[model samples]
Target: DQQVKQNSPSLSVQEGRISILNCDYTNSMFDYFLWYKKYPAEGPTFLISISSIKDKNEDGRFTVFLNKSAKHLSLHIVPSQPGDSAVYFCAANLQGGSEKLVFGKGTKLTVNP
Candidate 1:
């Protein structure tokens, strides 16, 4: 069974508006959640992350929220710009050791000018 899932395959937002991407997980053992942004021809770059101990984490215009009880998480981008358009993937893993990351298919976000 797929442990991670991105229910929305895509999202669209007007420039300077907010963009929200949702994700859910079935694994309760996952403690570290991460969001990665991928450009068309490049590898995914780490965006933001949250530990199970924290409910939220933010960096600049990007924010990540985790609800451990619901096994759900979300990424929020405020004042999204056209350049921010890209595919975002959600990943989860155990806190330590050689655990591998389980990634969601990805959600493509389009920021319109």
Candidate 2:
């Protein structure tokens, strides 16, 4: 099965603090991973991505780490802000030719000021 999973359904954090979200996968064929941030009534926007070949990738306040051996991944948001309060979906794709993506149910991140 091409099932990608996010075990935690939600997370909450105080503003200016760190927020972490976790995900897992059962399929080893997955080659590319992505994190998408979505707001109410809006489509998810591409946040960051890491190739299966890399263990870590970072962007400004966001960082993603992939552990291929464990079939796990995580996203860390530093100094979380109120604007960051939304649903985060961890997704994966086969990469190369097809565009089919598997997404988790999503984690609702609440940032309190």
Candidate 3:
């Protein structure tokens, strides 16, 4: 069974607009949540992360929010750009361990000019 899921496989947005990506988790034990962006043929790069203890974390144009009660999280990107177009992966680790991480299939985001 998958612990994390991204219901939307793809999202298209216009440049300079806000893009929202969502994730849902079934494991309540997850203590860390992360968002990664990957370009074609490139390894996923860490974008932002939020600890279970906090409801939200922000870095520049990217922000991640965690709702423990809802077992859900979301990533928001403001003023989306073409360079931001990539496959985003939602990941989680149990009990803050670096040993293993559960990842969602990913959502492909396209920013049109």
Candidate 4:
């Protein structure tokens, strides 16, 4: 019963610093929150999204924050580069029709240039 959880599989940053990705949820009926970004094999892409009423959501350098009473959600990458190395997935869904997303087995973000 892993509603969602990303207990830091990996995270390393240096190039320009600033890169935090964390997510945890026990499924309080998940209210639409997503963040996906992958490279290698290619798949996850969506990046940034928040809609549990809104706690915060950015786009530029990517930024997504949601703390629906501590269900937790985070993804902020601001200067970190090196092409912002891959793997970063945190998702949740339950708002519209078909948006079934519940993934969190990623965090591998290595950006050390």
Strongest candidate by lDDT = 3
Would you list the C-alpha lDDT of every candidate in the order shown?
0.94, 0.93, 0.96, 0.88
Top model number, TM-score = 3
Model 4 poorest 10 in a row by lDDT? 94-103
Q: Per-prediction TM-score, please?
A: 0.96, 0.94, 0.97, 0.32
Q: Write the per-residue lDDT of candidate 4 for residues 31-86, one digit (tens) a residue.
A: 98888789997777877788999899888888888988899989899989989899
What's the C-alpha lDDT at position 9 in model 4? 95
Where is model 4 more than 4 Å wrong at Cα? 15-28, 32-51, 54-62, 65-74, 80-113
lDDT (Cα) of model 3:
0.96
Error of 3 at 61 (Å): 0.3
- For model 1, the stretches where C-alpha displacement exceeds 4 angstroms are 97-99
Residue pairs clashing in model 4 are none
Tens-place lDDT digits, model 2, residues 4-84: 988778898999999999999998999999999999999999999999999999999999999999999999999899999
**lDDT, ranked from best to worst:** 3, 1, 2, 4
Q: What is the alpha-carbon RMSD of candidate 3 to the true structure?
A: 0.8
- Model 3, span 1-113: residue lDDT tens: 99999999999999999999999999999999999999999999999999999999999999899999999999999989999999999999988466679999999999999
Candidate 4 deviation (Cα RMSD):
11.2
Query: Which whole-number lDDT from 0 to 100 does residue 29 have in model 4?
Result: 91
lDDT of 1 by residue, 2-88 (tens): 899999999999999999999999989998999999999999998998989999999999999898889999999998999999999
Question: In angstroms, how far off is 43's CA in candidate 1?
Answer: 0.6
Cα shift from native, residue 38, model 3 (Å): 0.4
List candidate 2 stretches off by more than 4 Å.
none
